[model samples]
Target: MTGDVRGTGDGRERRNTEIVLTAMRELFHEKDLTALDRYWAEPYTQHSPRMASGLAMLRAAVPTLVGFSWEARRTAAQGDLVFTHSLVHGWGPGPVVIVDVFRLEGGRIVEHWDVVQDHVPAAETASGNPMV
Candidate 1:
């Protein structure tokens, strides 16, 4: 995935966003839940209905992610906010398309919001474009 970070200020914030997202991908793909502490804040706020608000809750849910595969399709950043569009295969009955937005403070992810939709077969879509 490619991300274009633009701003007149130094690229520190953009870099930080990239770092956090990269760590997130690693945590999911590698199943290294402990790595969350390095990229996320202690009292993380979760906006996803399925998840509780806290880093510990995320850690506890790691085991269920074992068979899932997360692939980042694109990323974008502005100021302290970073957004990612990704796909999660083997998550449920079919692959899911997910868009996640993260808020960062002091280089740590403090808040998150996400939207998930199940991938539809090409035959079911009017445009026939793949979801991811």
Candidate 2:
């Protein structure tokens, strides 16, 4: 619970991270793209190759999403940076393990980056632990 952003223990950075990540989860899982405007800055920076920079670009691509789902397994915040480890379903060929990093400014997300890898089958793992 020490690094948890959603835990009851209080901290402004943790609270802000939780709010933004919850909004993002809502946008992807609930198909409420409008939440982006509330949680993201106008000229948002993107480091993910699959996405273009800016909020407008994101809005433009939303309609093309056939199906999306995000299940966050962990969230942590330190200073202005927040990170989330999650399982993303229906985004590509199969489920993906994604670790997203966000930089917040004035409680809104202004920059973003993510590392996405296809979920490996349990039998393929050297260790028995699940990806999520």
Candidate 3:
């Protein structure tokens, strides 16, 4: 109620977006899910095909991965929604690109959605005559 109440909701939503992404980046690289309890609402529902809907499942399954690092490329927010595009690098299965969307309520992440795409190998250049 202090600073620009009209835009406050949108501003907080955007701020929460960055906060959530930062937390996720830290978790992905460090494998520390402790921030989830602090940043996410209870019974947070993530619309990921690979992750279960509850925090317990996340705590149990995330560490099973060999290595995972998520680097966020961009973020945009409107109303209470935040959209992010990111690239994930690691040595486990392979590199991946992830696009994520988050919905925040009262500055807390309430729901999440993401799509993961495997990084494609670069095309080989054709060189009829090899030059050193």
Q: Note the clash tally of each candidate.
A: 0, 0, 0
Query: What TM value does model 3 have?
Result: 0.75
**lDDT (C-alpha) at residue 64 in model 1:** 79
RMSD of every prediction:
2.4, 3.2, 8.4
Candidate ranking (TM-score, best to worst): 2, 1, 3
Candidate 2 residue runs with Cα over 4 Å from true position: 1-10
User: Model 3 over residues 35-122: C-alpha lDDT tens digits?
Assistant: 7766677668979877778778767766876656666666667788777766676723777767778888877777889987776544
TM-score of each: 0.86, 0.86, 0.75
Better of 1 and 3 by TM-score: 1
lDDT for model 1, on a 0 to 1 scale? 0.78
Tell me the spans in candidate 1 whose CA falls farther than 4 Å from its real position: 1-10
List per-prediction Cα lDDT, in the order shown: 0.78, 0.78, 0.67
Candidate 3 ranges beyond 4 A from true positions:
1-10, 90-92, 121-132
Query: Which residue pairs show backbone clashes in model 2?
Result: none
Q: 89 in model 3: Cα distance from truth in Å?
A: 2.6
User: Cα deviation in Å at residue 51, candidate 1?
Assistant: 0.7
CA lDDT, candidate 1, residue 5: 40
Q: State the lDDT at 25 in candidate 2.
A: 67
Per residue, candidate 1 scores C-alpha lDDT tens digits across 87-118 of 78876778998888888888888999999999
| Candidate 3 least-lDDT 10 residues | 1-10
* lDDT (Cα, 0-100) at 63 in candidate 3: 85
